[model samples]
Target: MSILPLLIIVPFTFIILALFIHHVRIKNALSLILGLTNFALAFYILKIVHNAGMLKTQMGSWPAPYGITLVADRFSAFMIFISAIVFLAVTLYSIQSIDKERLKNNYFLFTYGILMGVNGSFIAGDIFNLYVWFEVMLMSSFILISFGGEKAQLEGSIKYLILNLISSFFFVAGIGILYGKMGSLNLADLALKFSRIGDFPSLFEPSLILLLVGFAIKGALFPFFFWLPASYHTPPPAVSALFAGLLTKVGIYSLIRIYTLFLHHYDYFWNPIILWMGILSMVIGVITATSQFDFRKILSFHIISQVGYVIIGLAFYTISGLAAAIFFLGHNMLSKTNAFLVAGWVHRERNTLSLKDLGDMFNKHTLWGILFFISAFSLAGLPPLSGFAGKYLIIKAGIESNQIIVAMVALFVGLFTLFSMTKIWIEVFWKNTKNEKNDSEQRIKSNGLPYRYMITASIILALSIIVMGVWAKPIAEFCETAATDLLNNQKYINFVLG
Candidate 1:
């Protein structure tokens, strides 16, 4: 529990250190070292959670309902650990990929700032603190997104800012109402209170709904996901991959956290809505992605499509379903980040990601193309990959639950996902282009970032996808354990309050 605070403080300390470092190499070195350290700490926390149950610490030595609380359950620890892995990979890649001008401009600080908020959100034990952490993440992201001050970046940042502001507004308003009625902001305390309260008021439903909208926007669910496609591709790939890996997942984490803890008893009220949201996000996100020619844009939309699958698990409100959701969420984070990193490499080398203008990745950069193939096919749910395992679990659970429509949608979504992947594969990797320059000549003419660092970063994540796929039983077991914990709110409440 004491270690939980250090998760935030570690990155925060690096942010302070980064402020004083002007040299790009030193900043990059510091960032990479700290990122690895953060991952180690999170791994330690995960082991602790797996061995023990949930761990809780009260800030300022105040107990439970009166103090700021940080709690780590299996789910949160898993998320923090995965977040660390991506942070380290991105940091290493950014050393070479991020512009030197941006590196000198406290880029590492802003990056660390975002990590702090993400870690904070995962461990926060209450809604109000979660809201605070969301703001921290949003503020850092705003700066990072607009750092280059490119016209496209600024424009994208505006859409991101406006939607997030609305989200924050809804979030705070809901928090206000939650505290007003419950007289407490502690998660376990609220769970106990709501459980014991028996009947809920008419207004209580709206408060929860408001919180849902706020998280929906942050998580990029349909009808609220337009901001994502508009803005995500505008940033540098490192920033885009970080955002892809952690930002929306945090929102999804909150959704799972809130629903499993405080909102489970009210399932009748929210389950229908959850199903519709999941279905629409899956269908709309994938179909829209097919129309996009830009590499990053397609991946950004796929984020929405994949998020829908997780939501469907929640909609089932079963342990098996939630386990699948958690597993799928983890898989998607790695796959999506790697995909964007591949796009980054392409955009760097080919000077474009427009499908019509790009080709011959296999001919020129066979290794990088192979990396993309692993990530893309895994994302498309090919056999014996991480995506396949996750989808198999979800569809099986959906079928057993008699959610035939949900199961069918999951299957169809996978097919379209494959189609989307094939489109990118054919256009970017296989198709031959006219008037193509030789590799050496291309390198001579290009002002692109060097390939070694980026390839190393992508390979680290790519290997993870393969390892998780081949050695999936243990991971699946862990997800099942985490899912059980989430469903058993009494256990969570007892651990936090005791």
Candidate 2:
């Protein structure tokens, strides 16, 4: 009955209906319709949450702490709205980008499953339920990653599956320990329990460490992120885009949520470790991205680097800090996913992912070249674009927190990020334009496919980036409000327990 549950239900309903309808076109259309429906529903929910404060529903009319609870505040509603938009855009792009045989194998169904999982993660009220949504996401990603049966795809999927299963083990083990210690799965109740305990700090450390290890793995943070670059480059572009945009973010969101809600007023332990982690992830990710020639691999590394930007904001542990992080999170998804989509288009036109093998984009398709530039420059934190706005806010926050070294590291990384984007721009778009003989890109095996939908999707995303960058003040205000909600621990505690 609640809007929170419908976020998960919308995609799930379509996936089930897909089983009965045998027509591929009809099924794919339903996928779009599902995305659109969820997108609209997400706005309604957002408006309600914005107007009504946080909304909570206990399953089966049950009381808090005992029932499975679903809650949506500004942060959760914002995530659901943005995710639905990204999914819809990707689905539109996939109409032309995806392989036919893969589509026949119910790719849309798997896509919907992922949609349900991600939406579920945004609103789940308990740690265990969050883990359940993760399993749902993992299974769908496994199938999508391994689809088409390519040797590389299978290899990537295996490593991904293995690492994530191990992460799941740690997650469940930690959850078991937390429940054993507190006898509560409800996050609000768990927080209340922590308040009453004398040795809360000691109990919190082991359990939280275990949980963060799993989150770090899921979020692809340094030292635990090797699985991502190995696997992400192997999937179809659409799958890769969706994964790049949404999957790891759930982990990041969990970290933010748990720390703000359950681990309130604890700063002595988490701050330094997170600060160093962000610095390391940013430095390592940018340096690696600069060295890469594979298009998607480059973007994949950037995902790691950009996550560092978000983490840097979280590390600051202030209102402005969290707001900057939230803005960066939204900005990165648009820019990063658009970059992946561009790579897919390049592969479609020239059938290559290697930058050395791919060339003369400016002459062959000036339009796509321009679009790629917008996305690339945006990722590089160029002015009047999403990345610049996000990076600026993050650095500003870091400086305000008096973490001058951290801010300096972030700024340095942004320059290198620009260098990597420039490498792609010159290699893929400008290098071959000089040699007209090599400028002739091979046409698709079939030219019957129209470029309209693909271009339309890119345009929509590009415009969003531009608009968000220019109107960043409004977004920053909203993110600040969400941060306020998270920091106002007593308010959330009272609401949940009531």
Candidate 3:
């Protein structure tokens, strides 16, 4: 039996246990244990993939292209590992940050369901199976988004649900059309079939377009991104962090997986469309974020801009481009989540996320302030942080691929990002608004929540950002290898189809 399945199994096991347990502390402990176990399992799987190149298993012992196949190559393994880190961090943070009412209502169960879906999506070897995993993720996320049942949460959940359901419709419709034409849902088999159909490639273009729209909407690119900022700010910061860290990235991961497997064959059509989407998303996302007054709203909008970096890297279609995209994706997950975790702390202490009301946070808690500084600056692409390395590689890849204009746009976005981050820093940390409550009163308000858990979680992610930046070379090298594995689609096809 391969250990790869344990990633899914462990979370499912916990989900079942959560249903029978009425004790909140026990549930929290179980969730943490599940998180730690899954993290270990994901790390072990990554090591296995590193040593073995790829790992595969067929449910019920059915052979390739017939059975439900789960395969982990370099790229999938890397994503799973990073997602595990974010999940564990969020799980630990949720102990204190999530309200007890939500906790009693099976928050951990829904969260574990999300983990199962995310892990399953990464390892799924066929297109239809991928869709199933997507539904699983969305179902869990929808529940989490609406868990509070507050008016704002209900409004946000409605928007979130309708948009994602539309995305799923697009995705499944594409899958149906594709299977009708190709007579296969296995990704490897479809790739093989498509490789042989070079003459009438236009026949499948409609299906591809549908799929692209689905992925783009889910990834929150360009015009399809409005749903993100509208809903993300409405969730608890912990829930928002989980969604920010994992949900959108899965959509991007699927896009990259399909692109390498077959979509690249239509690069002539996709190149310009993808390039401009990236550019517009960068400009529009930052431009909108600059006007936001809420802490999470600004971060939510920046998620769009950061995702643009990844998409543009894909547009370059070079090894360096893909490597940078991969690295940037990982960096954004950690930094963005950490930023949200810090926001959780702010919300906990001040009971509001309005920047106008926030001031002297640094004086109140210098360590939390520093944590926010590290994450915010990292997102702004500051030196010696992961964002700098990611942006540098993306720009370098763009220039190397003769897309100088795109590279320049990326540089400018970094500056705009810096501006937004600085605004947050000065407003939230440096300025001393007259509305400041007495320190003792603020402490008493926050004292009910176990602030230590929130701080610990933020520190964990903050350190990961710093470490990723300081160790950029080795991680970047690993991403290069993952990128190579992705670009060399025949290797993936061979492993899965054999």
Identify the leading candidate in terms of lDDT. 3
| Residue 205 C-alpha lDDT in model 2 | 73
Worst 10 residues of 1 by lDDT: 442-451
**Candidate 1 accuracy as TM-score:** 0.98
Error of 1 at 445 (Å): 4.0
lDDT-wise, the better of 2 and 3 is 3
Q: Write candidate 1's Cα lDDT for 1-498 as tens digits.
A: 478899888988888888888888888889988988998999999999999968888888898888988999999998888888888888888887888898888888888989999999999997899999999999999999998899999999999999989999998898898888899999899999999987786634777888999999999997788899999999898899999999999999999999898777778878888889999999999999999999999999999999999999999999999999999999989999999999988888877889998887787678999999999999999878899999999998899889998899999999999999999999999998886455557767554545788889999999999987988899999999999999988999988888
Flag regions of model 2 displaced more than 4 Å: 198-204, 433-441, 444-447
After superposing candidate 3, which stretches have Cα over 4 Å from the reference? 201-204, 436-440, 447-450
lDDT of 3 by residue, 90-149 (tens): 999999989999898889999999999999999999899999999999999999999989
Which pairs clash inside model 2? none
> Which TM-score value belongs to model 2?
0.97
What digit string (tens of lDDT, one per residue) describes model 2 on residues 131-164?
A: 9999999899899999898999999999999999
lDDT, candidate 2, at 492: 75
